[model samples]
Target: MKINDILTLYDKILIGFVIILSLILLLIPFYYFGSPAEGEELILKVQQGDELIKTVAVADSYDEPIVFEVEGPIGIHTIEVNQGRVRVQEAPADDPLKICEKTGWVDREGPIIVCVPNSLSLWLESTNSDIDGMSW
Candidate 1:
């Protein structure tokens, strides 16, 4: 009935070890996947399927939004880049879901906005040569 009667000394030790291991696993991802956006020279990459369309340095973007159109399988996608952020300003009219437009602005790397209907994608890239894909 009581915890002492139900669990032996070995049982308590095993439970403690599991808790410690669980915490280590939980914290490992946070340590490895830290946000590297700070002071990063972010470059916005626009792509349609496997083809790379264009890349622009976020810092070099003007105060006035830089608008460009990319032709995809479906139609045209208007993308806006400004103030170290980029977004799909307008998706093809054929896209009823308008998922790309709804994705809003991406200010940092890691989060990718995709338009599967149009085969279009946008994401930020860190230009630091020192950083590897996975620093072991």
Candidate 2:
């Protein structure tokens, strides 16, 4: 083939190769880390005046602590649980400048309960089966 004809053929092949590479790159994330496999189970429990009240379970299995929010009569509460540990604290009662306390605990993935002046919450994390957040 002539030089010009060879060049045109090469251009088409290069373009096709680029398109395929781009598509493969886009799919790599979905294949590797897009959907994380189930992680360890985490459970949080809350108590009120010596009474067990609320419980929350993190569905996705993860090694890192997951932050969640709880609301009570006094104000909003922020909690973080990970590796069978629980951290509960008071948050701002109003909007704008809310802060969370640093009280935390650690235990097996079974029952973690907390009480905020009569208001209570609980978290239950399990690794035996697949549990969703709603199950909490």
Best by TM-score: 1
What candidate 1 gets wrong by more than 4 Å, as runs, is 1-39, 129-136
Compared with the true structure, the alpha-carbon lDDT of candidate 2 equals 0.55
lDDT of model 2 at position 92? 48
For candidate 2, give the lDDT of residue 80: 69
Given candidate 2, what's the lDDT at residue 89?
47
Q: For residues 1-136, could you state the per-residue lDDT of candidate 1 as single tens digits?
A: 7879999999999999999999999999667556554566889998887999899888877667788999877899999998888999999899989999999988866779999999888988888734455423
Q: Candidate 2 residues 2-119, lDDT tens each?
A: 7676678779899899999999999995574333246654445565555655566654325666777766666667776665456664454553333124334545443344454535
Model 2 lDDT, residue 99, Cα: 18
